[model samples]
Target: MWLILNIVVVFWMLIGVLCLQVPPSEFWPAGFVAFSLPVPLVLNFLFLIYWALRRSWLLVLPFAGLILGWTYYARLFAINLGQEIPKEAKTLQVLSFNTHIFNAYDGKQRTASGVSEEMVDWIATHPADVFCLQEFYNNRNTGGYNTAKRIGVRHNKEMYFSIGEFGRKYGDIGIAIFSKHPIIDKGAIHFTKKESINRGVWADIVLEGDTIRIYAVHLQSMSIRAADIENTYSAIGNEESFKKESRNLARRLKRGFIARAVQVEQLLEHVRKSPYPVIVCGDFNDIPFSYTYNQLAAELQNSFVQAGNGIGSTYNGILPFLRIDNQFHSEGLKAYNYETHYEMGLSDHFPISATYVLEPKPEEER
Candidate 1:
């Protein structure tokens, strides 16, 4: 049985290596596969390390390769922060925010009236060239206010929103985009709405004397019921799921995963058709190790991995170690600086922003 487990372990590691092929593309058709990818990654790591110490070096080849390969990629992947650009960026400073329906937090205060003040101040102070928000709300008829319009008015940017599952009239249920540059066009790509909502927004902005397509998105949030949350952790607070319920929980989670996979594929299809280079930034709600990030990031460069330090976990309210929020750019753009704003007491996800210089398109590469 022990021997069989090790063999299973090697095969599992092989799967992880295979998954490296799926880059972060808009066509992320692999659903919960994104959510569950870390399982094999973790398992393989432990087994290989244990085997390495026991003179079982030959059997550890697959995972050993995976570990070494990622290390190499990481070193190669480091963003060049100090490279000189030809000129000041006609570059747009885009921002992605989930806003947690404005129900997110810092640490002490619940995201309500008290938190709103600080957030509004933040918006007023650091107005992004373009802002994409998720879980936003607006209800004009019901004595409601359009968060998008209000924020835009505050920051002097154009705003567009799509209603997803909950609100109406670009009110409360969809993703939103706000741009300092003229918004040439914008809209959303919706996914399975049976359980959770999934969608991404696209905007065409006139920048650097050209139109660039920008995608601001929030993929399906990992569905966690009260029970799932409780069972997925131990008293020690490490991410140790209850063994007894692992199978059933995994099945339920897989459904959510499938839904997200479909969403990713739709996003990819939309992006592929655009006539210009693209930039994608969002609160993906999945970790860096997950399939969702990999799929969407396949064609683009991950700003976090490129320019960020430590793990940039956007979702700080819960499992804060998982780096889910990111800024991704077209292959033609190179990020020079990136930061996950962990200081603000606003939304649950950290605000990730990057300064990038456009790498001139070479004739052959173009």
Candidate 2:
């Protein structure tokens, strides 16, 4: 039994290693296996405890697995205890949040006023040099809930937005970026798919004589409907119904993973060729361990990993452990005092912010 368990441990570690690299785009099975990387890490810890209780030599296998996949562990969670908080005039504070289309309009959680009111109030008070919002809504009705324009008017900032594929007709729900500095240029890169809500928008903002390109992206979502979630939960004990619901859920997730892979490649290429240093922020809708995050974050410094504490989960949903929203910056910039604001309950995702400073250029360049 011990030998069999050890063999299973080896195979699990192999799967983790395979997942660290990109999976074949044409194969769903590989993507499915890649998605299971998080599960093996949990199992390894459980197996380590079991072996310790038995006082068995088999404990070495799981320990080795953990060591082999240390990169994934580091990215998923961190403890930046006692790290110095840098405060300087060069520091730029940035906030990124997915408003979930201001859930007050959802008709389910209808508050006394609405989420839009709370969000607008928060933005006015909690100051940041730049704000990137995903799933943003600009309803013309009810006197137009134009968040970007409203916030810009109140704060005196430049605002730019890219309406999603669906938003083109509905005229709401897209990605928006607001900056205190002057916006020299702005544009959006729409994904190839006709139905994909995923799109990326870039703004070249001039800050203190330096021009930085900021990309606000909303990647492909799983598109799991409320009805699908309800059906899956309600059919838990019914095997046939549960199986059908599970298949539908898995299909949506698989398609999202594949589509994001394609979308991110193009975005990364554009970022790589940018003339100015880049800061990428938005709801990736994918976990840190996934290929989407790994690809897009190639050389960029993840703000959470740099300064955030605890598990640093930005998601406010069933699985609170997931950190789908992120902020990444190129080498010239340093992230400090990263925070995930769990206090904001207006949306399914908590807001994340960080202070950043641009490193001085080399004397030779001057």
Candidate 3:
């Protein structure tokens, strides 16, 4: 019986590793299994310790499973002692956050008057040179709700707001990029699906003498609200209700996975063709184990994996393990002091920031 259970656990571990390579487009069930990756990974580690203590050869099985999915493990956890940035280093501080529309609406109604203002104030005071915000709100007619104007005016930075169809009908709300440096060129990457409020916006900013591209992206969301999660928990005793809630949750997640796969492909094409070194930042809305992350990580270096410590979970919802936000940069840049701002829990997602310095050009290129 023990041996049978060991085989089953090993098989589950294998599925998690395979999910990274096979996208949801090819096999939709892979999307559902991706979220369970961390569970199997932890179980395998425990099994290894158990077998080792018993002096059993079964330890090799769990050990092999760990090695097979080592990359996923590395991406999920970091243990850096933290590096010091030189005072004279020409560093560019960049922040990426999902503002959840500045927490303006609680369900159908507007939140308290000062709620959004408090969030905006925290962002304005942050010392980041570049801010890439997702689910950003800006109301042109209303002076108090003009978030873009408030932040840009306070920091004296240039702003680019990518207002979508939803934002146009309802007061403006979408993704935005605010830069302290001069924005030389700017554009938006619209997904093939016209209805998606999610977007990718890019800017070419002249930093000192060199030009660098910054891509601020917000991908397709799972659409799982806090109420939906609460309902799932509440229906635990009733099997029928539990099944209904679970299916609804699964359907939302599956749709998000499929949509984000197509969106990431579109964004990658634009990223590969960039003329300047690029730093991509935003709320990915998918974990590091998913296809969205692997595709981007292939082309760029993940800031958290390089410089951050611990799990670096960025989601501020009931689901504590989701590190769906990220910052990825091209080889021409070096990342330092990557951090997730957990204390400022004003939105559904915590803001993540990192400091970067341009790599020196080769003598021939100079």
Per-candidate TM vs. native? 0.75, 0.89, 0.93
What is the C-alpha local distance difference test score of candidate 1?
0.63
Query: Residue-wise lDDT of candidate 3 within 1-366, one digit each (tens)?
Result: 665666788899787767867778778898878767888888878888988999999899889988987877888898767488766556789999999888777668643343478889899889999999998887765777778888997679999888874443346667899999999999999986574558899999988888899999999898998889999999999999999999999999999999899889999999999999999999889999888998999889999998899999999988887899999999889899999999889898999999998876797247
lDDT value for model 2: 0.78
Which is the leading candidate under lDDT?
A: 3
Top model number, TM-score:
3
Candidate lDDT scores, in order, read 0.63, 0.78, 0.86
Which parts of model 1 have CA positions greater than 4 angstroms off? 1-11, 19-68, 71-86, 104-115, 139-146, 165-171, 192-197, 225-227, 232-248, 361-366
Q: After superposition, how far is residue 15 of candidate 3 from its true place, in Å?
A: 2.2
| Error in Å for residue 83 of model 2 | 2.4
Clashes of 1: 19
Q: Where does model 2 exceed 4 Å of error?
A: 52-57, 87-89, 104-115, 140-144, 165-171, 193-197, 364-366
lDDT of 1 by residue, 1-366 (tens): 645776665565455545544543433433334344556555556666666677675545646546644632342224445554457555666666666666523346432333254564565457467777777654443332445545777678887877775534323456777778888887777665453336778889887667878888878766655566566554234434355456566666565555555676777888888888788878776666555656676767787677766555667665546666778887667775577677864676767777666555676346
